[model samples]
Target: MRLNAENIKGMLLRYIVAIVILAALFTLPFWGGRYIVMLVMLMGMYITLGHMWNLLAGYSGLTSLGQQMYIGVGGYTLAVASTNLGLPLVVGLIMGGIVSVIIAVGLSYLLLRMKGMYFAIATWMFAEAMLLIVATVSFLGKGQGLFITEARKLVTAQIYYFSIVLVVITTIVIVVLLRSKLGLGLFAIRDNDSASATSGVPQFKSKLYCMIISSFITGVCGGVFYMSQVWVQPYASFSISWTVAAVFIVVIGGIGTIAGPIVGGIIYVFLSQYLSTLSQIGSLNMVILGVIAVAVILVAPKGIVGTVQEKFGFEILSARRWLGKSLAKVPVAPAPASEAERES
Candidate 1:
């Protein structure tokens, strides 16, 4: 038997995707306005973060409440490396990811033993502890925190490009991982852990893998997220806002599908950005989002993508089809009438 790896169609498809996404990214920062670029970056980060949390909480059935711990660690690592250690912002971001991995291993060990509500509470408690610790540390300026001192000189265009690259890489990694055998195991576990275990899926290991992957991506996102702001503080970095926002996106987008997070994240970011200006009722934005999430879950528990799959036989999560949409018809786009036919 011969293996089929580098088929022409696959290679061409990959190349086209790469070119289109790259062209869009490079052209956007150059021609698009500052707010537009910012929105793009926001969507990228939201997609990555939402997907990360979804892997652990949604797919692997892990109820982690303390994802902020990794995010905070990554944020602080970036702050310390860039400010105190005098490293370049880029290098500091890498260091942040490396440090976050270490922290995640330890925290996972501590909390993975707990299940359900216990697991959720443990995660929350871990984040609270991190927040308190960072608050009291003088070197991190206690509550005041660190800012990228000379980073103002860095070009915004460069940051935008970097964010685009990060999103591209994250999307690729997620797609590949989800298509692999392990992704199959995760699905099984998510649906029924005991059954998957009985069938030899290694449920615990699969869950742990999901947690680590989710942590690593989310941690790196935190690093990049802070670098974008050029500042890091305990209150903001460790804020439950990350958790809340990610949760909302996953819930709204369709928890288990690849397109869910991306679609949901974009919607959440734009909606929040626009609705935040209204203060008549005080935080009506969150209230509205919360209500919407509840309604979506109750009405369409599978989310937009999931519901589409159930109703329309869509396969948006397939690895070969990145950026898959769930809508059934491609909108036949009215075939332009032939010139002669129109005349007749």
Candidate 2:
């Protein structure tokens, strides 16, 4: 609860490292090739999506397979808002997240009732249903989808910078949340909801809060992605592949840790990109990726970051409890007893 000297040092170190990395990434467009910038932008999008999904599934224990629902909702909302309202792309991006928040609020009641495999199935069903619904709506382009004519005119540099800004915003929000009391409650619930409830954690409220935040961020990512693509189709936007990618990256990187998703995203993107170049494998790249994921799970169930931290005692983004335990381990002299007790 209190920011001790060690905590302050850790905070400063974390911020310094983040600032340095951001400074380097921010200058990529100036000297880096255009293709490299685009590739980085794509990585940023996946990182944001991975972070959002990890917050809910990894930290909150709410494994949703329908995150694409929000992604689709966000993408469609951006397309509509920009086309119909004549809003700026920035405004549409904000609107996309807001619309996702609204949808999450309405969907939480029913979805939250289920648990385990049942919950997963319900989410997938919901996403499919939404895809069908969106496909039938003329305003949403009736499956043909909608394109943001205005966004199409924007250059890749502008889109790449915007993507970076969104990723940074999402990372900051997640880091802040994970350091708060609510974040502790989230981790507690993830470990054991019944125990957490007995210990005064509000299970439903914490889960819902995580869901809303995750959905909003995911929605924004979707909007940015489609804005850059210049088009959105129900089949592609709402494809379950988005969720699969999130789960794969999070699982491979280390679930429930802030650094995990980013590591996972980078690894997944690079591996996928490299595999795609192999002419022999071609369409079988995903199969190879799946094999690797399985191998990682079998060898290191905690994922890359988690395994490294466990083995090396590293704490780049350790939880508060982790820091507390480390601090507790340090030897300290016992305080003198009360004067009356000493006299006695």
Candidate 3:
């Protein structure tokens, strides 16, 4: 049997399963309350953002602290478009995404020059610069910031439904990316950047592509989040903690695999909420997170998914022999009486 056929079959099977899961989630907003909706939306953002960050730091080996740069840009862009331009909120949301894309392309040119901790530091500084710029810009209302022109009712049900749809789309994109040929280059880069380059993989192009895609998704999420808040301020809009949340989400869930964020974000979200009630400081949550991260790093360096793979001997990494196993268990056809007759 050809490898292509087997690969196609696997891809098809995954998509079919994904569609069903998404459909089930689409109904959640109708049944759940405002808080539930908020948590789901946040989980989606954290998971998506974590995956995006993972693509850079975990896969492409480009750690960045400035991801919120694009997130903030998206929020501000959405605000401007929805209000002054008289665009629909959705259109404004998309425009925010476009802005983030533009920023990714422009920044990659300069930022890509650095790598390792240097890259991370550059990104952190870039985020700070964004905060400073937003503070001084009068048209954008300077540091004081801008809010949506209108204050509206909760409409939690509607927002909840919207969050469900967005999460579905985001999840689909992530699963597809992980299963595709992109994973080959991504894993290689993660393992050894120099080797991946020498192996004919366009290192810069792959990294840049990841950045653009990651930033675009994060930007869109930021847009939605801005709308959810019904306000946009530079500090909150471009937050370092947003980046930190994403990092922790990926770390706790599993860094390289797509499933990690889903698992990790869900767990972390609940932990934060539960712990927040215990103390005004939420110090318990932080301490627990810190301890878990340290343990996970030591015990499951590959992350939650990695640990699972280890325990179950499931090979998600393509390099592993079993990853190439037949998704469809080919059955041996028994020779029928007619076949025996024909052979005779």
1-344 per-residue lDDT for model 1 (tens digits): 12245555665886898799689887997789989998888888888888888888878888677777777877788778878898887787777777777777777777777788998888888889889999999988899888866456666676776677777777788788877889878888888888998999986677777777777778878887877888888988898778888889988888878888888898998988877766555358778889989999999998887788779975664643233221221323456899999999
Name the candidate that leads on TM-score.
Answer: 2
Q: Write the per-residue lDDT of candidate 2 for residues 1-344, one digit (tens) a residue.
A: 45679878987987899889999789999989998898889889999999999998898888999999999998998999998889999999989999999988898999888887888999999999999999999888897999888888899989998889988898888889988899989989889989999999988889899988988889999999998999999999999889988998999999888889889998988887888787466448867888998999999999999999889988556666664554566545776999999999
Candidate 2 deviation (Cα RMSD): 4.0
lDDT of 3 by residue, 1-344 (tens): 34577678998887788778677567667676668867887776666677778778878898989888877887888778877787777787788888898888898998888999999999999889889999899999898788765324436556555556666677667667665667678788889888988998888888888888888888887877777787889988787877877888888888877677788878778877887888787556677778878898898887888789779976443333233253334434554678669899
**lDDT of all predictions, in order shown?**
0.79, 0.89, 0.77
Clashing pairs in 2: none
Off by over 4 Å in 3: 1-20, 150-154, 282-288, 315-344
- Please give the lDDT score at residue 95 for candidate 1: 76
* Candidate 1: C-alpha RMSD after superposition: 10.6
TM-score of 1: 0.85
* Candidate closest to the true structure, highest lDDT: 2
RMSD in Å for all candidates: 10.6, 4.0, 6.8
Among all windows of 10 consecutive residues in model 2, the one with the lowest summed lDDT is 323-332
- Which parts of model 1 have CA positions greater than 4 angstroms off? 1-18, 280-282, 319-344
